[model samples]
Target: MVERLRYPGGLRLLLTPNRSLSWRGNVRIWLLLALVSGIIAGGWALAGVWFILPFAGLELMGVAAGIYVTSRNCQRKEVVTIEGDTIHIESGLNRKEHDWILPVRNTRLESFPPNTPFDCHRVRLANRQQQIPLGDFLNNADTDALVHALKARGINILQTEQQPTVGIWF
Candidate 1:
């Protein structure tokens, strides 16, 4: 998901992975699954296989953990701001994990042409001093949209016809 906002000082782009289910919706689905599983486990326990109950509980705990992780990942947000001559990038779930502030004139957008027809382009924000990745969590379509938005905003995007086969970007 992309939200573009205009402020007095600059433009801000809020990027998030496309969400089909809200946090509450996820919880509701989990609850339904848990209730059904719990009932089945209770029935098994009552049939004298009591040990199955503990295993069922453990399985539910593991599933809950997985749900929690997914929820946190889905809640992540990446904020990119362009103000005057500076560009700022902040990424994290609820707090900033990556904070990059660079001069807009020196910074350029670099993307690897998809390595395969099914691959999504890997994008990076780079300057003489540092190269930082952007939109690692976005889908292929969203990534393309991000590249287009950057291009429209007059940010330089490096295009190399050769697809990188083996490389490390720092």
Candidate 2:
């Protein structure tokens, strides 16, 4: 479920819903622990154990708050368009924009494993000295095609000598 959220000034962001982080997104182990805690609470409630009900309620509240914060923080509204002088990236509720050089001569796009160092999509993009995850914006096929198009247009994608072992979360 890919939905498009657009803003003024030609800024477009894509929202991919129903995508859960496989074992990788559970960095804090909240989801895993939530399941266990929910079961315990449910069992206790069923057995007329009233005291543990409060603990269960607290845990449930914590999980809900965590999810809300995560969703809000992950709301990175990426804006990619060709302006007269630069390319821009805007994100968050404030919609701040950053301008990169017209031609990012040192930009490189590579496919990296998902949920290795950071929990994100499988593609990694390197521009100048900065690295950003490309998964949030482009799908697998689209990313590959974009890389090829950029390379054909004289954008250099420096390949790394050391290959990284990709992690796949079940």
Candidate 3:
């Protein structure tokens, strides 16, 4: 999801991934699975199959961890603020954040075409020193929206046929 807010200085783009399930829904799913598995496993354990109990506990723990990670990822966000002659970007998952500042004139955006297998469109923000990926967590439609929003804000976007890969020098 791309939210465009026009601040006093310039534009602010708030980017988030599209979530099909709500927090409550995710929790409900985990709870349902855990309850069902626990009942079946406990019944089997009572019938002399003691090994099923430990396996069921492990399965429950794994499911809980997976749901937790997914929830944390859903909380992730990237904020891009274009003010005056510079653009500021703050992005991270959870509490750890990274900041980047680039002069408006030096900054540019590139749109890479989707691959034959994945069908994921990539948008990247770059300057002389670094290139930061934008909307990498979003879907194709959301990425399209992000590109359009940046373009509407006077940022030039370049289309690319292939994704650029960097190779380390020996």
The TM-score that candidate 2 achieves is 0.49
**lDDT: which is higher, 2 or 3?**
3
lDDT of 2 at 5: 47
The backbone clash count of each candidate, in order, is 0, 0, 0
- CA shift at 32, candidate 3, in angstroms? 1.4
Where does model 3 exceed 4 Å of error? 163-170
C-alpha RMSD of each candidate structure in angstroms: 3.8, 7.7, 4.5
Per-prediction TM-score to the true structure, in the order listed: 0.87, 0.49, 0.87
Q: Return the top candidate by lDDT.
A: 3
Q: Which whole-number lDDT from 0 to 100 does residue 2 have in model 2?
A: 32
Candidate 3 residue lDDT tens string, 17-136: 888898899999989998899899989999999899888999899988988888878888999998888889999887538999988787889898875445588989988799999978
Q: Tell me which residue pairs clash in candidate 1.
A: none
Name the lDDT value of residue 85 in candidate 2. 32
Per-residue alpha-carbon lDDT of model 2 for 38-154, expressed as tens digits? 788879889998789788878778876877666655554444443333344443444654433333445555655343444334554566666655435445555555455445545
Return the lDDT, model 2, position 161: 45
Worst 10 residues of 2 by lDDT: 10-19
| lDDT value for model 2 | 0.53
Q: Name the Cα RMSD for model 2.
A: 7.7
* lDDT value, residue 104 of candidate 2: 49
